[model samples]
Target chain A: MKKLVNNPVNVVEEMVEGYVRAHPDYIKQLQSNDRALVNARETKENKVGILIGGGSGHEPGFLGYVGEGMADGVAVGNIFASPSPDPILEVTKAIDKGAGVVYLYGNYAGDVMNFGMAAEMADLEEDIKVGMALATDDVASAPKEEKDKRRGIAGEFFIYKAAGAAADFGYDLEEVVRIAKKANQNTRSMGVGTSPCYLPQTGEPSFEIGDNEMEIGLGHHGEPGIEKGPLETADKIADRLVNDILADIEITKGEEVAVLVNGLGSTPKMDLYIVYRRVEQILSERGIKIYRSYVGDYITSLEMGGCSVTLMKLDKELTDTIDHPVNCPMFVQK
Target chain B: MKKLVNNPVNVVEEMVEGYVRAHPDYIKQLQSNDRALVNARETKENKVGILIGGGSGHEPGFLGYVGEGMADGVAVGNIFASPSPDPILEVTKAIDKGAGVVYLYGNYAGDVMNFGMAAEMADLEEDIKVGMALATDDVASAPKEEKDKRRGIAGEFFIYKAAGAAADFGYDLEEVVRIAKKANQNTRSMGVGTSPCYLPQTGEPSFEIGDNEMEIGLGHHGEPGIEKGPLETADKIADRLVNDILADIEITKGEEVAVLVNGLGSTPKMDLYIVYRRVEQILSERGIKIYRSYVGDYITSLEMGGCSVTLMKLDKELTDTIDHPVNCPMFVQK
Candidate 1:
């Protein structure tokens, strides 16, 4: 795999430099650290600061959400790898206003451990209040009784939008955490992979599937899925994902929800909409109200060929916050 | 390749339905047509109304730019195909206040023809004034003397930002056209393809390349490229693309430039940053001031394996607009 980098180790640093340089109007890198904050010009002192951290590769998640009415700070890890506690601590400190800071991120093991450590460090160093919420939306990783064990997926968008709005609406740290956790609890996701992806440093696929086969419920780290079968039609594929997710979440009929048909990386928009069409039909038949729908690559696994479906049941608070305005290079509300 | 669409013919309409439903607070579909406008709440009578339009599949382009300080209206077409003239005319009329309207779009045959026809129709029907500018930034499309024949790539972002700023600053239609054209003149892009894309309708690749080979200077529509050779190192790829673009645009030493490392569709960030790493080194060595840089899948070709580099020489006015604040669902300038 021919790559355009100098040294493999420098790829992350250089990429971060370029990202900061590109969006100086919205975000800036903390001094010599792998953490970024919304430009101070746009930071509000009274608003709860929302911070998200995770390994890189999920472009629009951790970093793309940093701007007005979204995330205030983002700490980035190396590709598919966790950032150290120092950067996480730095970001938490930088964004902490008088109100407090909310650390919203996926439920990966490394992320949970590192962010927990960073939260402790920040609590000791400053008078800033801190809270954390884990996004565990993927249904394949856990059973209903073990929902907290599921990995996060593209449903993070809803969590961020809701938590960001809560903060924007002058919610305290605990309030923001409560709302964010509620959004996560109501969200469910499932993914299927048609092709594998290669890690840059390894230059080898993280997982493998046959050319004519696909793996459903694949993890972001390319872990094995629960089901491997022949490539199926979009309708069938959507049915499998929706069935599994609906069964896991046990969404009642006529409930309102937001749907996200996310491309893992290499799936085309046409394909995503195809899956969405089936998803919409299935949900509509169940008398569900789709409050909103998003179709594209929100969270990806490098360039893997796959798509995931995320459904989030919306309450008045989630709906209001999800509709709140966000200004970022990669996302907007209005 | 497997896809998620029900039928290729209905993909665009279905996706548009989902988009408008998802972002009703930010956008609305124009009266049963395939056109969309920024929410009426965001409009002001005296503000210069900026409009953009093009084919679909380029997810964040024409549609994504609609919001405050960006496009006021967007007309969309089928995948990799231009919108019909009626939608373009509808969007123009819908966005045109007493203030003039600016038609900003890529330089594609279908887009130019359709938008041109619509502009003329608008002039014939109402007293509203309108002006159009074509984005021609792909340096690989033609020689210096034939630069006008170049295809627009990711540099459309710069043009959109500049044009949006011009309109935001209350520039008249003619003045907005002038600045947008100037930005296009100062921009250049070049791309490489590891694989070709299949049109959903056709269900076959638009073009083909060998597994070990890549095509350089490929266009967004899967057009034939300037050169085809075995895939090489990421640094070598970046060197080739940057060198060709800089030479084509006659980038001078000490000039300030904004760089965009854009993924065509399926190229991963791991690969994108690898390319950016080398691109930065080459630009730095030339003493060129990189005022800003962007790396992502901006303008895509379905799920193609390729990437493009765009360089725009920045002057005060262009930089100011590029730095100007924008609040939209997909693009936010803080």
Candidate 2:
């Protein structure tokens, strides 16, 4: 394995430690619970808190978004494993103000179970009202009718942005949840994987594919994608990803969207741009207007070689939210 | 090759087209010279235009740095190759506003020859004054006395930051060149490679290494590094890189620095963070302060597996310049 790490067992600890050390201006580890990385600056009183977290490995995903106007707190787990209820409760309590808190994360079985347990713990122990908006935007995971059951992909970036902006915009907890849910519902993502990421601890591949094959809907945790096929051109893959998303979202002519061509892990940013170019072409041909574009590794699966194309249908509010000023560690939007 | 691109010959063109479309607010493709991506918003009159460019493949390296308060324009080239004098001249003419323009790019023989030719062309044809600053921060490439012969690695991020900020801060082309040169001199970087990146066009590896072996101080373009050794732990490797940098530059106690732990391409950000943790430990132990930090893929070598650690020694002026607000498409500092 080409993974550069120390002991695999201590990967999360060192990662979180280094992350806090790297961006002390924006984030700090929770005093009691080391797993939680909260905003260094104090969250405004009576403003709803925006907490986003998930399993580790996908760096800058859950933790990179933590800042004053972005994710208020992050509860980090071990590699591809959810944080226990304890650290989640700690972050929830730390970020909570009189207005309560909202939890937004990718929709995965481990996350759903763990975050739900933490919400219950927070409610029972501290009387904190918590709202949740699980991002279920991966279109390749399930049929359109079963969108609710789909795993959240890179669309979590949009969900986190909207939720964070809404929270900072002084919206109440319920409204923040609504906005987060709306963003998740409107966003669609599909990923194609050319190579698998190895587990740092075990040095084991997440999944395997033939040297010249790729899987269209492979999940971040090496979960099954739609199908594995022979490697194709960037334009062809972009066409396939865009078609899959457009078919599920039903974006009308002249409507606007925020296009995010995200590299899974090892896919080069140059290729992502090439893919974004194709996505833009297909959208323009279909009369869909692109409001903004983000191309990079917003979320990744360790060293997995692949990419995902996500489109978040935008309205006036979502547009404003996307344009909202942000100072996150991973993403800085002015 | 796991590259997601069409005909390798057109990678640069498609990349430039896609880049301009993705960031119309910050950059636009030049009409007369498609290779140049200049500021979308009209540059302020009399402001020293800061133009940065080199080869493609390193996404967000030269092209990503273009914006109003950052790089004024960029001249893109094919993968791992320098832009011709024609496009460079066009960018110089377009960005020139009587105060002249300054060109800052990595120090490469091809780039030096091409950009030097462009400077002469601009002087003879357009009568526009041009200043130049070559980034030479790759400490592994040369000895201290031969620093001028060193290759510019990820340290270009800081060099561009200083030059762009200095130019936009109303400094003349000469002053911008001076500041950029100072940044380049003060910055030092070392990189390690575990796996080589395969060129999309040729589907050939940049270099080869045994599966259990790694190279220290490897150049991004596959130049030889220090030595081949058994794959070492992240901590041991970080120690070697930091030691080499510190030994070369006398950053004494209480002097602050801006640390950049960058991914070459395919190295996981999680691993970078782990590496950063070790780097921070070493710095803390030595009483060398880390003023600010950037931990991600700022400049990349396509899908090469490994990372580089860059440290830019900071003074008050460099500190302010580094923190100066930026709005580039690839980098945003607020």
Candidate 3:
């Protein structure tokens, strides 16, 4: 209930307005469909278009990622709600340069359906080639065999970066989609939720937990996780997350990886770095090499208290392009 | 009390350990004084050294701002307490290359005493010339006549940036100190606190407030504010902050300024953007041009729930040097 928002209903509209105005040099919202934020440096180049989005609560995620050398467009939605196909189509049409567009987003049902419909619309009505890829890297959401059923969390940032880099390298729509799939396949994430975030509209806690308890493996939107227990130390939590992620993927000794120790909204950066310290120790002990490190809030549930660890096993191409220059509002790698 | 830490008493020690290890490429802890984090890309150049530091709780503040084209060294301390003179002297000696060094930090009593003692020590022992600048940009802490009494808060980030750029451009220690002083004078900041943050060692809220109330003009460490009132809408709060800042400074029409809508840890970036939206509208109506914008968590007080707005009026020197390339772990510009 302590959200600092005006008119809970218009948070999305106001957020978009503020975002574009603040980062006016790199981003702008569509005049007709304000929810669709596109690159301010939009050019009719031959590169394939990269479009990414989801709900609005995850700031610096979809909107902040639309800039030079980053995702070209984003179709933002209401807090924790997927955008309809209208804005998706608008972004698709805006970013397309006859090289086709690829839709990438979390594996949520609403997003999948809406973005899929937008892809069909772009193909049938606009005559623009469209492809799709879903990020399914949250290992806690499903079993290894049912990986496609898993939800996307902070790992989606890596997937988007890989896809964007491929497109920036002049890859075709199909190749970009292929890279997105490969990045998704290589990425794994697990998060712990210490507390729930209250929604501005309802002014109610998304869920409840005991004062000293935390949910392990919870989804971004408070979906039930694997277990609930008294919160352990940062080292223990980092150990659990790293162990779960390693078990979900085939990454082994001597393999290099890109690491993301992401804040789940309210956790302190100190806490995330402490967790990263332990993660590095764990990885080093296992003979795994961490090629790059990111430790901060990338994607988040509104004011939710927790952290998530993501790792993307890097190949030759990914390692060379991992530092792909991006100047987005949220995730910038320069 | 919901901090994701291991040992409460060892929070600072672990934090430094984690920070250095996580960013080994850009930062490394001093072997002699582990609390001192120095730029990993150190060189024996003759340019004046830009050093920054303070208490530990403000992640990405003193520590994260050390890298190429940024500050050279940081004298880190425990949460909410200033560092001793030993680490200060250590950093001063490490970064100083014949050209001497400049010390810039928040205008806090403990910091002044400690850094002052270290400055004397460096002059007497190592014969390394040293100049100092204090960031006094928290307009809420004092009247214009007693500006030196104000705390640094988020506005100090701009001071550090200006000083670092001044040094990088091969300015002498005296000139760097002058630029830092000017940057501090031109900056102003105001923040609101919805809830208090708990210290890791104490495991208790630093201050208390009603669930439906917020303290406007509160300091970073839950210090007293100008007023306490019912939590108002984001727009109303933004208006109050902007009006107060404008009244404090004489920013005329057609002036250019940089804006920072910073989250105080737990406040969502969504709310910060909403606040920035209003901030932008007000500045536009006043005919002030926004030269650049930064919206996210920069200098945070652990997981305190609130946000702060900062403005730095730009002159020819500041405007040109504002985007000076920096690649620090926390703050980056390209």
Candidate 4:
């Protein structure tokens, strides 16, 4: 309720306007539909078009990832609400350079339905080749037997990075799709939410929890998680999240992996690193080699207090794809 | 307190441990003193050593900025408290190349006392040449006639970047000092806080406000600000912060400046951008061109809800130095 927003209904429009203006060198909203943000300075090269989209609360995701060597286009929606097919189709049409467009985003019902509809429309109506790569990497949302039913969380960053880099490397549409699938298959994430986020329209929290309690395995959109319990120490939290992710991902001894200790929203970077310290200790003791580690708020729920840990089991291809340079506003690499 | 820390007393040490381990390739603690985080992969070349430090809670601030083309060393203190002279001296000795070491940090009483003592000891005992550049860019903290009395806030980033880049370009200590001074002179910042951050040891917020109120010009350590009022619209807040900053700085028509709308920990990037929308519109209407802009949580108070706006009036020299490539975990520039 203490948020610095104008008419709550106009948060998306104003945020998009400010985002495009702030990063004028990196992104611009489409003239056809202001909801679709594309690379400001397109190279016009015939690389596979990487298009990402989703709800808007998770800043620096979906949109901030649109730039050189990353997503070429991003369709934005209302807070925690998926964009309609119209914006998705517009972004796909605009960024496609005859090399086809791949729709990338988290696995949510509204997003899947809307993006799927956009892909169908692009293929049938516009004669444009379109594909979908849904991220189902949050292991806590489902049992191992129902992996595909798991919701996407912070692991979307790695999936997007690898997929975007593959497209940047001029991989064909099918090859890009393959890389996305591989990234998603190898990535696993789990999160605990200590506090809930408010809906801008209602100015009320999405859910309620005791002040001293936290929800384990909560989804990004405040979805119900596996269990609720009293908040524990950083080490215990790290143990739980890392153990859950490792149980789902087949990272073995001497295997190289990329790790992401992501803050849900309001968790400080200091706590995330403290969590990462335990995660490193856990993995190192298991003889797993960390190729690279990212610790920050890569994805988030609005003002939610928690953290998520992501482990991406890596091979040479996955490593190289992720290592490829990206020049986005948030996830920049040289 | 709803925080993920093990022991309040050991928070700083553990956070430092996690930080060094997480970024082993970029930084490390000095062997003699764990509080001094130095560049892990030091270049033996005799470039001027750029050292920065302050209290702990501001993650990515005092330590996250240490890397290639940035601060070569950082001395960390406990949360919101200045480091003792021992770690400061250790960092100075470790990173000091033949060109000498420069001490850069915010202008606060405790920091001045500690870092000043360190500089004196380095000169009198160790014979290592040391200079100091204090950041005093918080416009709301002082009157125009006494700008030097203002507290440093997010503007510390620009000052650090310019000074570090100058040193990386092999500038002499005097020139680097000049650049740092110039960056500070040209930069101005203002912030509002909706909630207070808790001190780890105290296990309570530094200050308290009504749920519907906010403090304008709140200091990073939860110090008193200029005014307290009802939480206003994002646009209104943006107008107030921007107008105050512009009035203090002599930016005229056709002048170009870099803008930074930074979140104070818990505020979402969505609201920051919403604030930036009005900031950009106001400056544009006045014909002041934006050279470049950065909007995110570059510096933060742990779990504080608010945002800060920083404007750095740029010239050719300042622009080049600010744009210089930096390879740090948080502030990476290609």
Candidate 5:
């Protein structure tokens, strides 16, 4: 109830309206479906469309990436709830270039079911070829042996960056899907939550956390984590997250990778860098080269206090794509 | 306190160490003084040095801007306290390329005193020319007739951008100071705090408010604002802030201005955009044209829940400079 929203029921719509208003030249609501957002500048002719969609509350994730160099469109759902087939289809239609459209989203059960249905419906009724690429980069969500079963976390940012660059480069839908999958496979993330976030509809937190405890591996939508334990120092927390991510990857001592330290909602950027300090130390000691590093709230749960560390074990292609220039409202890297 | 720090007493130094670790390619600790941060890449020969410094709690504010297209160096201070004269002098010495150095920071007493003393000392002892440019853009901090008495808020971002661009373009010290002053003169801002942020050392909020109330015009470091009242709708809060800023500036019809809707620490990015929605609408209705808009956490108190609106009435020079590409770790516009 402490949130700075109008009516709780109207948070999503207002957020969408405000976002488009704030970035008037960059994004707009789909004429056919207000829940679907598309870049104001139309997708280039004959280029593969890059569409990313997911539940709301993760600002700058699915919607904020809609721009010239990133996602062409996004279908927004209610808070932490998947978009229905309607919005997804609308977005697919809005951003579909002659080459077809590719769908990129987090690997949550609800999202997978919804986006999958949308893709099927688009192909059957609308004659649009929709390719699907799910992000499965959260190392703690599943054992390494079951990597495909892991839910996506902060690594979704890297996937979107790489895939968007590929699509913008005029890659075919299959090629775009390949790069998306490759990016996801090369990425791994793990986080520890020190606070809980409330669902706006219920105005209550889905789970309880102690004043001095931390929830390791909690999902963006309050999913279960490894365990709740007494809060530890920044160095120890960084060790835990970095170790979890390294265990799930095949990074060699001399390999180069991109490091991302992401803050979940209320964690200060200052603290994220503190965590990044340890991440850098461990990687350096292990002889791993950090090709580039990003530290910020790239993706977030609404006001949930914690941080996630993501590493993309990069190949030349992935690194090139990540270094590709982007001009989105939330993130613009040159 | 639920902060992810090693020791509260060591927060500033650790943060400095961590920031350099996180962005080793963009910034480094000064060899003369660890508290001073200099751009890893040296400034172009003879370009006027742009040195920004302030209290430590405002991450990304005074330090994050130190890079190729922004500040040349920064002096880091203890949490919520001005950096001592030593670090300021060290930073000035590190970045001075023989042209001159300019100081850009918020209008705070401690910072003003310390920086002014450093400037004096540098001129007399080190023979370095240092110029001062204060940011006074917070409308709520003082009445329109007493605008110079106001404190600086998020408007400091625009000041830095304009002044940094001027300096980077090889403007003389006087021209850089002129641009910085003009940007400050044309800027206006107001904010509302929904929750208080604690000082890490004290582990207590500097102030308090009821759960249902908010502090209008609250300063970044918990300074007193216009009033404390019941928390209003996002639209109402935006209207209040916008009206206050407009009342203090001569923003006529057909004039272009850049708008910044900044979140103070714990305010979710979603709420910030919701507020921006109304800010844009109000500006449109008043016939004021928006040249560009930025909505994010630019200047923040550590985990304080609030949002501030800033307007920088723009001219062709300011607009061109704003659009100029700058590569900084936290902010990049291309």
Candidate 6:
């Protein structure tokens, strides 16, 4: 595959540099380091800081949300790789205000281990208060009893928005962490892939699927899904994803929920919305009140052909936070 | 190729519906019609309404900017097809706050003609003043003397931001139109493609290229590009795109500009930022001031494998407006 890059090893560093340079008005590098934080021109005065960190490949996740009313700081790792404890510590310290920092990130094992270490470092070295919330939304990774074993997917949006809002509303670290955990617990997601993505350094797919077949519950790293089957219609595919997710989460009738129909990477908006239409209709038929919906490529798996659906049961607080005004290059809500 | 759509003809309409539903806080349908408008709660407050429209396939164009401090309404057409005059008229009427409306759209012939008709209709029937500006940024299309022949590509973002700011500053229809036209004139874009995207309805690619080859100056609709050659590095590709755009527009040293490194659907963020790194280096070496930079799949061509670079020479007003705060689902600036 043809790629626009210098040395493969430099791709991640170069990308982080360029991204920070582009959005300097909203983001800044952490004291000569690769870690970044939202400019936070007005953040220091009003609330606790919200921190999110993850691998670099998920563009909008770890970086795109670093702006007003979202994450205060984002520690980026290498492409699909975890950031070391140093950068995480740097980010944690940079965004730390007097109140404390809430560390929210996807539930990858590397991220969990690294962020945990960074939290310890922050508490010991900087005398900063910090708490962590793990996103475990992908239902295909584990049964409901093993929810913590599931991998995180697009549902990280809910955790960030809720936690960010809680912090914005002057919640302390414990309160902010509680809200984030609640959001993560109520969120559920499942994904299916028609193809795999080629990692930039290797130039080979992490996993593979047949041209005419799709694998359900695929991880972002191109790991195999729960099952493989011939390509199906939008409705059938939506059922597979939605059924798996709904079965795992206990969303009651008339319960308000926020739905995110996310394109993995290469899926077109047309197909993504088609899947959303079916998913919406099914939810409506079940008397679920969709508080809001998000349909786009928010979280992606490079150029893989697939999408995931994330449903978050919402209360007034979660809804208000999700609707909070934000201004970032990749996402905005007014 | 496998697709998830219910019907090809319904793809655009269904997608628009899904978008509106997802962003009801910011966008709404034009009185049950296909067109959409930002829910300007204070429409009676006499703000100059900004309206943009075009075909549907370009995901973030037209629809993505409908929010605070951006476009007030968007009239969408079928996929890669222009919207008829009625929908444009509807959007214009819905957004008209008795302070005049600025019609901003791409330079496609159909859009120009349709929006022109709608502007006339609005003037005659609603006593709402209207002015139009066309975005013509594709460098390969034509030269300055023949500016009307140039195609509009990803550089439309500059025009949108400028127009939105002008409207926010309470510029009349004529003044807003003039400024928007100036922004378009100062902007130029060039794109290259490694693959063509298949239209959902046709289930066939709109164009063709060899596996080991790429085409430059490709349109968003899978139209033929200017040149075909062997695949090259992202840096080499960025050099070609930036050099062609800068040369065509005659961007001189020390001039401030905004850069957009846009991915055409299937390209990954890592690759897009890699290109941006090279692009920034080239511009910096030339002593050009990059006031702003955007990197992502803003204006996509379905799932085509490619990227485009857009450069807009920025005046102070344009720069301020491009940097202004905006709130929408797809774009946020804070």
Report the number of the highest-DockQ candidate: 2
- For model 3, how does the per-residue alpha-carbon lDDT over B1-334 read when each residue is reduced to its tens digit? 6878998898888878888888899888888898887999874589898888999888878799998777999999899889999999999999998899999989899999999999999999999999999988888899978988999899988888898898989988888888889888899998989988899987889788998999999998888999999999998999988888898888999999999888888999999999999999999999999999988898989989899999999999887668898889987788
Query: Could you give the candidate ranking by DockQ, starting with the highest?
Result: 2, 3, 4, 5, 6, 1
lDDT of 6 by residue, A267-297 (tens): 8777887788888888989999898888888
**Per-candidate iRMSD:** 3.1, 0.8, 0.9, 1.0, 1.1, 1.8
Tens-digit lDDT string for candidate 2 (B3-104): 888988898888888888998888898889999889898788999988889988887798988985689899998899999988899899889999999999
Give the higher-lDDT candidate: 5 or 6. 5
Model 1: per-residue Cα lDDT over A1-334, one tens digit each:
5444556666667667656656667778888575555544545887788888788877666677788888888888888877778888888777777888898888888998988888888888876788888999988887889988888888888898889899989988889999999999999999998987777677788787886788999998897789999988778999999999888876788789999998888887656766887888899899998887777778887778899999999878889987787777567556
Number of the candidate with higher TM-score, 1 or 4: 4
Categorize the docking of model 2.
high
- DockQ of candidate 2, scored on C-alphas against the true complex (2 decimals): 0.86
Each model's DockQ score: 0.40, 0.86, 0.82, 0.80, 0.74, 0.59
Q: After superposition, how far is residue B77 of candidate 1 from its true place, in Å?
A: 3.6
Model 5 pairs in collision: none
What are the per-residue Cα lDDT tens digits for candidate 5 across B1-334?
Answer: 5888777788888778878987788989988899999989987789999999898777778788888778999998888888999999999988889999999988889989999999999999999999889999999888888878889889999999998999978899999999999999999999899888878788999678897899998999999988999989989998899998887788999999999999888888888888888999999999999888899889889898989999999999898778867888888877
Per-residue lDDT tens digits for candidate 6, residues B273-322, read: 87888899899999999988889877887788889999989887788788
lDDT of each: 0.81, 0.91, 0.89, 0.89, 0.88, 0.82
Clashing pairs in 4: none
Model 4 chain A: weakest 10-residue lDDT segment is A40-49
Give per-residue CA lDDT, model 5, range A215-309, as digits (tens).
Answer: 99999888889989999999999999898888778799999999999988888887888888889999999999999999988989888899999
Clashing pairs in 6: A3-B234, A4-B234, A5-B234, A327-B332, A328-B332
* Greater-DockQ candidate between 1 and 6: 6
lDDT of 3 by residue, A248-317 (tens): 8888899999999999889999898889989999999999999999999899898999999999999988
- Provide chain B TM-scores across all predictions: 0.96, 0.98, 0.98, 0.98, 0.98, 0.96
